[model samples]
Target: MPYDFGTWDRNCNAEQSQPLTGTLTGTIPSWLRGSLVCNGPGLMKYGDHEFKHVFDGSAMLQKFTISETGMTYTSKFIKSFAYTTNTEHQQIVVSEFGTRGCSVTKGFLSKLGSKFQFDKMFSDNPPVTLARFGGAYYATTEAPFLHRIDLDTLETGEKVNLHKLLNLNSQCPHPVTLADGATVNVHSAVGPLGPRYEVVKFPPTCPAGADSVFAKPVKLASCETRWKLNPCHMHTFGLTEHYALLPEQPLTVDVTAMVANTIKDKPLIEGMEWLKDKQVKYRILSLETGKELKLKVKSESFFYMHIANCYEEADHLVFDVTTFETPSLLHQFKLENLRTKGSALAGEVDSGCIRRYVVPLNESVKAAPEENLVKLPGAQATAHRQKDGTIFLTSQKLSDVAYENPVVNPAMERKPYNFFYGISGDMTSNKASVGKVNVRTAEVTRWDAPDDVYAASIAFAPRPGATAEDDGVLLVHCVHAERRRVSLWLLSAADLSDIASASFTLATDAPRALHAVYMP
Candidate 1:
């Protein structure tokens, strides 16, 4: 039998169930305390209206609190304009990443007048992930609007649009938090100098009463895009002790198409086009001086999904991230493709692998076009100066297995660390497995999922005073695809072994989620 994709068509948060205890199939750790707060797509469709892409669903916030008293689970859908308006109208009234209202295509005449409904042409639903800014939690997507939600009750708060403070249309969902409580994220904006990207910082403090918690953001650095009208989409970036590495991949957002699509009553994602032949530019920004280092770093084009870690080692900046050979990863995720492709959907993303890239730190070093500048030992990566003044980066696979959402110990972030855990979108197949990877040895140890079980990404909670990097328990949100059930599984981080003694099963099958965080 093929995998069931029915969950993609259902709204998982229609009912309210909270403080529900799990019928533990395994024993949960007695010492575990705190909560696992998660956010992702939940409400995928409404009356006569359905989202086109998996990411087009409405934001669903979930919480699993672990204590000696046992576990409790609660889930609720965020009241974004997309969700409320669609529910009020009994159809999709707003345009999502790839889906628009049927009225959009009723006739060319209707589309021409959709210009008057430009407000309905965009959406603020944040189904991507949970982000922390200025000591407050928010559900964030690629859009400028972030829906603030209380971490304890999952209640929605006032929305903050970064555009109100800075002229940015899109914001990176994955942001790097600094030691001083400031959060740094990349933003895309177009001004007098055509298209450009900026590294913006939101300090820990906020005004007593303000419209935006991110008002008066400090622009660390900005760079012009290669194209005059299009800017490469940035999902995430790399941050070291002193530098922020921004990858300008070939996948771009066409500004002209976006405005035209809004006026034409078309989905915004139609403006996004992937240029596989374009080279990836690595723009290095100095953290201290808030300036761009004039280093022409370029590499063969590839789509980067997430940066696991970046650090300075031996005068070289080393970074690791999940890479896709082409933009097919995103293209293959359309709702129609997921329902029809089913199990094959897992194989589409299996081509993604973790890649290690190294860049030379010296500002004024001259080398031959073919001479490798990376001298750090045991690193199979290299950087050679090209004849065109471009420092070409060549990377090596950190592990043989392909994975998504590669994560490490939070304490070991932005520094060298071994043993990173990974989870797959489809764990029922043999193509990808939930496991741990040894970066130094390139050794992968996996815990294969049983039949009909799919897994989310890995979240870690470290054991107290533990010296080993993988000392705590690993948490994974698993769906029993056939049994119509969802649960939180705990595994011994020391080894990817199932801790049958300490896991919690949800009252019902959860809507699909891409990422989660362990709050201790």
Candidate 2:
């Protein structure tokens, strides 16, 4: 059987079931002892109705425990308020980021009620990423709250309300933990005037002494846009030792338009307007002082979904991202497009490429715009110095293949690192493979999946007390199209060689995961 992109949406119904043990193939590393946890859309339909977008599916958490003997697998749906309501009522009563309610009246009432009771509409899908913070594991989405899960049981715990805990409206699932064990993430809040962006830091452990009284997150930096509108749709941000980078794309949300669209029972994605003429703005904020520098660059309008890694050099801040030419990629995930196989849906969406951008920093915020500004060949360029100093901007394309879900060594984050491992494929192709790129050099190493299998993202597990940087193992989840089977492959990080694999049979095809994490 050949690969079918639509088969990935088949419901697995593996919710809150007993652990299925699988036999290991190849040689298992004696030192590899821990669990790998991943979360993504598990249930695509409720009762008789099916979700229009993949983002609307109920979040399911999957866990695989690795020991010397064999591997044990378990999965459960995150019993979020939205998931429970939908299952109990047999309908989508809550509105998601992309999927609206079942009826115009119900959608309007749900939106109205959300303003007073936030949890009623909160979709704790936690499908985006898995994070370990403050000595506890959390399943997080774009929502303001983080759903705590048991590391061993894969069961849902109490929902941590970020708004009440840190006065944050919403937070990105991708967070960077510092060397001192402090986890940091970017949060955004929209207001009548404009949107405010904040960088928050949470300590390793609760300093407040009680679970109920968690320590308040410390604000590292913040900035408000002047447009009185949300500055595009941001999935992740870049971080360095001394600076935080936020990319303000041309795709923006108008508060007035959104409110009106909500009343009319339209999907939230419909209200997003893409301004092709506007240049992308990169906001650089100093971690030490509350100073901000803005650099506007001109090029074909594009959107960034993930950041690979970022670091600082002499007087420059550099980062890499997977760039899409437009926002049409979101529309490609519609059920209608997924159902149509062959060339109709394949090679239709633009594949994303990894691009690197360098920004030179200024010492003072009031420096003249032209004093230290340097423009490279591109679309358009505007450089401005912050109160502290001036900064310049430049960019270059790095990889030939489309890359997404990039990951780096956790110890090397916010610092200089060379190799980056991620999922690579053509934007027009449905197949995916694992590839590692050496940033310093332009060389890339790839391990293409068989034509009958689709590969997901790779997670790096660093060897204990290792000396070299790439001295670790890469874990990837693969799904076979013919048998509807799922398998976990462990490869050598140095050369992409197959080290071991654990295969298991699933009742239905396993949905593709957006991201994964390995806990050792």
TM-score of each: 0.92, 0.89
The sequence of per-residue lDDT tens digits that candidate 1 reaches over residues 1-520 is 4445554544564644557777776677766788887788887778766788877888887777887767777788888877787888778877788886655346777656664453455578888888888888888888787888888888989887666556687889988788877889998887787877788888887856764548877888877877887788889998888888998889888888887777665776788888867899999999888878888898888887788788899888888877877777566778888777776665455466778889988834668777888988888888998777889999888765556777888888898888788864342343235868887887778877666666765688898888989999888776555334666778888888988422345544467777898887
* Per-residue lDDT value at 379 in model 1: 84
Backbone clashes, each candidate: 8, 15
Model 2: worst 10 consecutive residues (lDDT sum): 374-383
Q: Where does model 1 exceed 4 Å of error?
A: 1-10, 102-119, 207-212, 344-350, 425-432, 501-509
How far in Å is the alpha carbon of 338 misplaced in model 2? Answer: 1.2
Which residue pairs does candidate 1 place in steric collision?
A: 26-500, 26-501, 26-502, 27-500, 27-501, 27-502, 28-501, 28-502
Which candidate leads in lDDT?
Answer: 1
Model 1 RMSD in angstroms: 2.8
Give lDDT per model, in order. 0.76, 0.73
Off by over 4 Å in 2: 1-3, 103-122, 190-193, 209-215, 294-300, 341-343, 363-392, 427-430
